[model samples]
Target chain A: MENEFLPRRVRIEETKMMTSLEKWFKLDAQLDFKPGQFLEISVAGAGEAPISICSWNGVEICVRKVGRVSSALHQREKGDFIGIRGPYGNGFPMKEIEGEKLILVAGGLGMAPLRSVLQYVLKNRKKYGEVTFFYGIKCLEMMLFRDELLKLMEEENVNLHIAYEIEDEEIRNLKKRFPERFHKGMVTTLFEKVKVNTESFVVVCGPPIMYKFVLKKMEELGFYKERIYMTLERRMKCGTGKCRHCVVGIGSSSKLICRDGPVFSAIDAELIRELV
Target chain B: MKFLKLKKDQIEDFFDSIHSFGIVYAPVKSDGKISFRRAQNFSDVSLEYTRSQIPPKHVILPMEEPILKFREEEYFEVVDDENKVLLGVHHCDIIAFKMLDEVYLQPPKDIYYHERIKRTLIIGLSCIPDNYCFCKATNSFYTSDGFDIFLHDCGDFYFVRVATPRGLKVTENSKNLFEKVDEKDMELFVKAEKERFERVKGKNLWMIGDLIELRDENFWKIFSERCLNCGNCTLVCPTCQCFEVYDELEEDLKSGNRFRRWDSCMLRAHGLVADGHNFRERTEERLRNRLSCKLGEMRCVGCGRCTVYCPTGIDILEIVRALKE
Candidate 1:
């Protein structure tokens, strides 16, 4: 039997500074993974952290300088080899909602996972219907994949809605380019601008606080509970269910976020009272 | 499965016979606490102890161990394979082993735990309840499996029940020391089990599942207020398997060992995530989570380790009874 704890070595092909805190890494490994699945990125002496795979074809992860593992990751550049135990967790239900309209909701660093989903949709463009992407970030500085989002704006049939908390020069310049798409408000505010079809499958990935407000907005907009899928985050050790740190719910209903899900529907995530 | 007998005088020889399997660790009393310790001699093993303060989970999963050793780009898996014999493990603890197996030996198996558990042999000992024990109420009083051999204490003799091939081998190898069970010996063995059942007095926690649904904040706050969050209960718990991984560097910063250490959910850092977000910030919230787990999926074996080990006098049995009320 293979040791699940053993991490495979992957060298960094390239690295980019996305924000003051977040750094993007392009690995020399092509992992077989779905949209929302994550990798347990280990930095030897610095330890491990669950980083979401941002690229579909190759292994690309965005690391936010939040804790030890990520901080150590930021220090390392291209040519550095790190150990990775991953592509774990139930990723986005891409096949399930293949033919349906997709409402992609992402906040801050949550875009990393959604980018994988969007990339898959963009690849198999003929297999999907209308695609709507709603991205929310603090400002231009914190925004990840800004160039890609801009490129996505020009794509036929795909609508990009960008929400910024602060309205600065860059935001004004972006708004001047696409007045209808760019808006000055929170992620929930973007919902008011769009005509949300109840039939559309909504995939929301964001901070813990974003869920309550976003779910409420989606509910008010008449989105079905079954169709609204969201990826969650927790302090994970073993991506396997052995470590009870990332567990959600209580008793028999308890689920290991690492094993059972990082992606759970709004209805299923309801078991976690603090979550949805 | 077959029943045999070993007289009290032949225990030393019996212990000696089992030595070929591996090192035998049995209960021993030290500093007014009972815990499993390696027996160099038969006399070192304590046969009269009701329960060990700590469960024998370390036999499978150690408190701390190195998983990997890294030097620059090269990483090597740290392997520790030691054949072990755990003697005098109570039925409650044996059941706890089964629970650990469910998590570790399932699909995406934890290789470390799987390797350790496979090499280790279990020799269960029947135990009667003390004031701290409620294994009977939790339906873990009797365990017919999860062990190679089980010994029922029958005063002058031990009524041995062999459940595995290796267990039968031990009996076969030490056939001279064993004797055929007579009617009186069987009677005494049955009586011992009856005594265990009668002495096991506590609330039936199996039906207390609804207690987790109790939204009374004050009820949980009462316990949380007294809780030091020292995480002593999790350390002593047979089934609490939460852990955190870190790295210990050698003098040369290029090389280090990635170690996994036992972590407790009671600590504030357990739930604290990056960006200073604590999902379970309040004491009552963490208390509810721990109790809900004990009441829910990770059912307490009712060994009463938490009740006895808690610095403050917080009795889980009393809490269960109160929840029932």
Candidate 2:
């Protein structure tokens, strides 16, 4: 039996500084992972954190220095080896909504998983319909993949709208960089600026506090509950579903976010009231 | 069921026979408390225990279990093996293993736990619940399976039933010490195993299928009022599988082992996630989640460990019993 908890030490092939808090680590390991699936990266004595696979080939983990494990990861330089186990959890349902218009939404650090989903869709651009990506972060100083976001604007049939909650010198600098793409309010403000079809498939990933307001705004704008997909966050230990820490139940339905989902429909999403 | 009979006096021979298989552990009286310990002497193995102070689950999921022993790329899975024969396990514990097995042995299986299960054999004892035991009310009163063998203390003689091939092989060593149980002895053994169940049924009439129904602020006030948050209940639990894993560097500094230690939801740090979001920040919320999660009917296996070891005597069963009102 393969020990799921044992992490394989993989050398960091490349490292990129996206922002002060977030750094992207490209690992020298070929993992067959779905775009939005996650890998539990261990930093020896510091411990492990569940990081979403952010790149196309699935080795890159765009992580924020939010906790101990990630902070330890940020301290490590290129060519350093970190323990990794997974490419675990169900990713975004690409096949289910194939050829349908895709509205990708994210808030703050939530952009990590949505970036993987959007990049995969862009790989075979003709297979999907119009793709509108909406994102929001605290300020411009927290921006990640600025070069990549700018390059994505050149892609045909793709629309991008980004918002900053706090206005400062960083916001003015970002406005000078991409005047048309930047907005001045929360992610909810993007809906009025860019119109997506009411029946189009929507994917939303964000911090816990953003779910209620974002989902409510999407609902008021006529987006159906079943059409909205989301990735949930919980205190996950053993990602194999052994630990009950990540168990979230709604009504008669319950799912181990590690196993059954990190991805859930808005109907079942309502059941996990703790996220609200 | 294959039944064999042995006198209470002849039980020493059974313990003696157990040594050849492996180390045998049973209930022992030390420091005025009964805990499961190595049965070094047959005279010390006590079956008079209503329930053990510490569950035999530690034999599988220890307080600190190593997952990996590593030095960068060259790492090996750290696994501990011991051919253990655990004695004096009650019906509640047998039921508890079923729930723990569901968590560890199911797909996306835990190999560390699987390796331990392979090396261990359970020898069960029939339980007589005192006023404190509420296993029967949760519909986990008895288990016909899980252990390799089950022993019923039938007055003058001991009735033994072999439930597995491993058990039958162990019992074959001392075939001469046993006699076939008659129909009369079988009836008495079955009746005693089931009779105490009725007394516990009406105590907890709380509906748990939907958790929102059981929520009352007064119940929270009362349950958390005495809860010292010592986590003695989770430590003694046979079904609580929540663990926190971290690495400990050895003296060499180059290599170390990653340890998965038992963690409890009752702790303040248990619910704190990345980005500093605390799901259960309030004292009552943490207290409520533990009861609510178990009420969904998965984690708790009806072993009243928390109640038995609670310092302030906060009976979760009685608190749940009041929830019915």
Candidate 3:
């Protein structure tokens, strides 16, 4: 009962300045949570917000200053205290899709959650076949986790594709750092570059507008919708299903995105609202 | 079946007898609006009312509640509600509580809500449908369970059925107040039940096939029109249980409480992502979401609070009825 609303105080081990708007926080307390799961972090003045786990070795979450909670988190330095709860929501079913190819996509901050799978796949490299990650962000300033991304590019049997909407000096540095892996357009352009076969499995996370275009492109390229996966986000208050703020109706029956899913197969994405 | 008879003259004594159960809240009319208030005296309780403007669900999940208290980055307490007994709850609203139980009392159940439920007793009343009432249409007017006691109004007396053991004990303690019902009393009770059920038999607005086919985008805009997104509909609804959580700090910034307040999808920001993207951008989309959530294939208990409380007089049932066109 106490665990329902009580959050443990976790100290920030270290903080890396990703960009002006984003920062990476490494927690001293490592929680027993799977890849693709997220934690609700609450500060004093700002309320709780869900941040996706990007690291498998430690408790690391990437925070983007898009709202009040994250903005308040951005101001804090290393060793500051923050309230934490969860490892909530079903993560990517790694064991189910084993021995198959993977197509991982990340748009802007979407990279944070997908990075969890990226690290997990790299560790168990033989369990998966051709693994590809398509990461795209606006311009170059919003691009996150650059040092680790460059390390991922060098790994054998793993391919990292990067795209920038607009060019900047930071993007040029990234192009030089990863060499031939960088592209000049949106992430949709990366699909044209991919040799998407029947065996390839897909995991996608992005802004709400990105799903329609990305899914359409995947279908056009002979990618099966059943094998594709997505993580849907809503204004979730209670990570559990008690608060109905995160509910999305699929036909007549309703499902809470927090409890029923944050990770859903592409076919199951019907539970979320789509823009026409 | 555990029926007990309380004469019309003994209703006042019946209210006085319930104190040992918990603090009692019954429907009362104040400022030209009906609401649940603590029964200081039974004379203030309205027995002839159609429905209270707000459902008694607030007793379980309040509009605002302090869930956690923290001081200097350390949590010290989790607040829980005291014992309560809700009086004059309608059968439809009783059904709504069951739906709420399905949501909050499931696995990894809400501790705060379960704590509240453990301490509360429900007393249900049977209602004859009014102009704005549509519980019969939703098939929720008749409740078999989910209440401690159910009071069915019969002429010259109230037929009270003690549904739970706790209710039986309470009734037994007040044995002097109730008389054994005769054959004539049973006949009158059956007649009232038949008449109430027959009046709203053919006027159902909820059909699964009609709801599925009402997907025209042009039709959706009509829903948000002649309207304000004041969220009064969801606020007044017994089944609408969405909420938003916030953290408040003292001026010194050392201590504060984390609380949750009722929220509605009708608000433009209800679907806002943490990264600051509002998914339900248009008012039409917001309205579509609530309607789909309310009646799309899901069971509507048809409390009719939304229709009664809409300042713009947006009849949600009329829109569903229009779906046939």
Which of the numbered candidates is closest to the native, going by highest lDDT?
Answer: 1
Question: What digit string (tens of lDDT, one per residue) describes model 3 on residues A1-276?
Answer: 655668889898999988787899989896888877888888877889978888888889988888889888897789889888898999989998799999899999889888889888888988999888899988666788877777777877678898888988877887787777888888999887655665589899988778888988887887887898888778778888877677675345557778877888777764344521
Model 1 misplaced regions, further than 4 Å: none
Q: What ranking emerges by TM-score with the best candidate at the front?
A: 1, 3, 2
Structure candidate 3, residue pairs in collision: none
**Cα-based TM-score, every candidate:** 0.98, 0.95, 0.95
Per-residue CA lDDT of model 2 for B145-208, tens digit only, reads 8989888877777778889999888888778777888998888776765575654444453456
lDDT of 3 by residue, B55-110 (tens): 88888888998888888567755757677788888888889888888888887778
DockQ of model 3, rounded to 2 decimals: 0.61
Q: What is the overall TM-score of model 2 with all chains considered together?
A: 0.95
Computed on C-alphas against the true complex, the DockQ of each candidate is 0.76, 0.58, 0.61
lDDT per residue, candidate 1, B243-292, as tens digits? 99999889988898989989988999888878788878888888778887
* Model 2 Cα lDDT, one tens digit per residue, A1-276: 678887888999899888888998888998888877888888886778888888785478888887878888998778888989998899888888888888988998889888888878888788988889998988877867877886876666689889888888866776787667888889999988777798889998899888888889988999988889988787787788877677665323556788988888888766664545
Better of 1 and 3 by TM-score: 1
Q: What CAPRI class is candidate 1? A: medium
Chain B TM for prediction 2: 0.93
Pick by TM-score: which candidate is best? 1
Candidate with better TM-score, 1 vs 2: 1
User: Model 1, chain B: what is the TM-score?
Assistant: 0.96
